[model samples]
Target: MDFETEQATRYQRIIDLLSPPDGTPTSTAKLEGELEGESDDIHEAITDLIAFGELELVNSSQHGRVRLHQPTPSTKAQATLTDPTEYVWHAYITERDGLGRTRARRLFKDREVAEEHLKQIVNVETLTPVPGIKKVWCASLGSKGYTPEYAVLRREPVFQQADDPYPESR
Candidate 1:
């Protein structure tokens, strides 16, 4: 990705991680650790977000803390697009039914839980094509009142072991 796109992605990730409904303040150090991003890049993103009024710097005992709250009244009109509750985690699976494939989805309040479920599905080993199992993944879904958006968080092919008992190359 180009520099601008990469920076924007990092900024979005920072916002998502910090903007829980409770309006909790997160330490800059913790955000850096979570994002596994360079200190300079993370700080730059934080600065840009602060300027945008999507985040507020907190004067906490520990240095470098920020909290996500309603932006200034001037920016309130734009809040819906950046609201904490706007995005929700969704876990989805596609499977073969009697004649065609069916898709199933589960909603999660926590991103970590959805990710764990995705991992479980992808890590399972099947000797044969498991009867209806097709594909599984987890993503974040944007709520209504605007264009629906989805961000695929995690996905991987299900692990399978070769079922051939006799070796062809032996």
Candidate 2:
């Protein structure tokens, strides 16, 4: 009855407050007004946001607004490429240096782009994982330091002995 109505209102309020939830700022007062309930509803909605990992609470002096902060990979520093698929090629841009004196952003797209980028990261650098194929690094956008090492580069696909490279569609 009344409780159901209150719950529905609160739920709708949260949905409307965090629409898209892409680093958008929302205030407690706005949520409370939208819920059309007492002050406690705001707390509940905030709790929900935290549990969902969509909200980044900061002091009023810092943000001055309640907003969401999605988890993004670190692309500021350089790390070992024991794996690369764990990171996106072009998504995260990191600072690299040849002699640790120069610094620049490392943004590569595919194997070709990675080769070019690797040329810039000098001083004890090599290919992603496949040894003897130095000067190439690729990372997966899946997780941290978990690149797809299984993927072989420049390897021919195994066919059933009756396939053409570019066959016409039937």
Clashes of each: 0, 11
TM-score, prediction 1: 0.38
Residue 83, model 1: lDDT of 47
The best candidate by lDDT is: 1
What lDDT score belongs to each candidate, Candidate 1 first? 0.45, 0.37
After superposing candidate 1 on the true structure, give the runs of residues whose Cα lies further than 4 Å from its correct spot.
1-3, 37-40, 60-62, 72-170
Best by TM-score: 1
Q: Summarize candidate 1's per-residue lDDT along 1-170 as a digit string, tens digits.
A: 02355665776788778654245578877888888734458766665455333456775465577776442212323332444234455454322111111133456667677666655654422212111112222222334554322222322212133322212213
The lowest-lDDT stretch of 10 consecutive residues in candidate 1 is 126-135
